[model samples]
Target: MVSTALQPVTLSEFMQLHNIEESPAWELLNGQVLQKPMPTFYHSLLQKYLVRAIDNANSVYEAFPELRCILSQNSVVPDITIIHHSRIPLGNQPIQGAPDWIIEILSIDQSVTKLISKIQACLAEGTQLGWLIDIQEEVIMVFVPNQPLLLARADMALTVLDEIALQLTPNQVFGWLKR
Candidate 1:
């Protein structure tokens, strides 16, 4: 979440300067470049398990880790980006639009506010669901368009896209790290 001091750059210019394959991905939000926080052990585990869970739940949608997506003026690399199989763009280019579901796992010392803003941006651009997983708190904050924020914990089932058949809880997600 460290912002660079360089002058603001457009999405095209930002993409030209930074490659998606770069480690410790960079994001363009509000025309400013920001580096994503390195993933912690728990963060990495959750991302792995969540993507697996999502992909296994249904074939209609697929989940990807750290996939860069271009949403309107901003470009972000969500921890996990889920999109319908039919909507997946061809070729080696970054995703051209917001994903169907955007998941962001909170890293140590990462700004929750900035993460929420990023999620909201995706939602504004037609993303159906957004999840902010707070490992320290053992809770997930769920965001959906025109819906009140939902806090899910313990055995509380999280909401997913209507077409997906996955059923998940915070405990199930965190439990992956225990193994």
Candidate 2:
């Protein structure tokens, strides 16, 4: 008797067909492959501040700025991914498991349809926190599983990532964009 085997489509396999060359700052999210654009002046400013702030806080967890990960069949590259020190996986590829926190810096290339699905997928995949930063609105939509999201304006403080007891004030974060 002969047996037939089934093959599964993996995110890594998908990326291979995408021409994903080596770039220090590239990521893939949910089959929607992309290379991060040259950070607009504002993007670079916010990214630097976020990385610094998280690093200085000294959490037991690790926070990676602009990290890439494979979420099921899709490749998601979040702006920042904070993973529990214990949960972090071992590998040279870096992101071996779901991150504890994910930050997506909204960009012109992203669509509303795309962002919502990716956020929902992350939440379901063991990511504890997710933030969608809308640069023009200076608004952030914070997501935590089984809870109402906390949306912040420039003045409000968002305690989305509580692992380090840190809260982000929108006005303060956006201020980094000032010319």
Candidate 3:
């Protein structure tokens, strides 16, 4: 469901209402609370596979699932975030910075234009790469500087960080939900 509010609030005020068991996912984008749907089974599985594969390839990546990215006065919890291991926050709060990689799994409620805008925001904030995975179309949209590539099938493997030797077949990822 979309937010019913006509006015925006401060990011600090937004964080104060944080609860892990909340119904929908909420983020402070431009200091306004943005709510999106919770993950379905397929979405959740892909998230896990990405994390596990990354962890297996290199133990040094600081990967967090649903970890909030704290900005100047707002917070955004990307679906999955991959940062350098040295930058992991030790406390109860999320860190500020465009994570090296931010992955967003699409939901039916979000518009394509809106998602692109969000990816652009990440790029402006210093994110090296942003991925928008479309489950329905079975394609992955990758945003890199000066280029945007769409991978329609798992056979077309994807690579975000070059240092890590990880490969994911789209079919393998989607197949996990069948069982």
Clashes of each: 0, 7, 1
Model 3 stretches astray by more than 4 angstroms = 16-23, 152-154
> Model 3: per-residue lDDT, tens digit, 1-179?
25534688786678777462265667766645677677787778888977887778875675678877876655677788988888788787677777788888887777677666667777778888888888898878888867756665768777668777777766766676676
Could you give the candidate ranking by lDDT, starting with the highest?
A: 1, 3, 2
lDDT agreement of model 2 with the native: 0.70
TM-score of 1: 0.95
Q: Best candidate per lDDT, number? A: 1
Candidate 1's C-alpha runs over 4 A off are: none
Scored by Cα lDDT, where does model 1 land? 0.90
lDDT of 2 by residue, 23-121 (tens): 434444544444555456676677778878887788877777667766665666677787777866666575765667888778765565566677778
lDDT of 1 by residue, 1-179 (tens): 77874798888788788454568899998788888988988888899899989999966999999998998899999999999898787887778899999999999889999999999999999999999999889999999999999999999999999988999898998888889
Q: TM-score for each prediction?
A: 0.95, 0.81, 0.85
Question: In model 2, where do residues sit more than 4 Å from their true spots?
Answer: 1-9, 24-32, 88-91
Error of 1 at 45 (Å): 0.7
Best by TM-score: 1
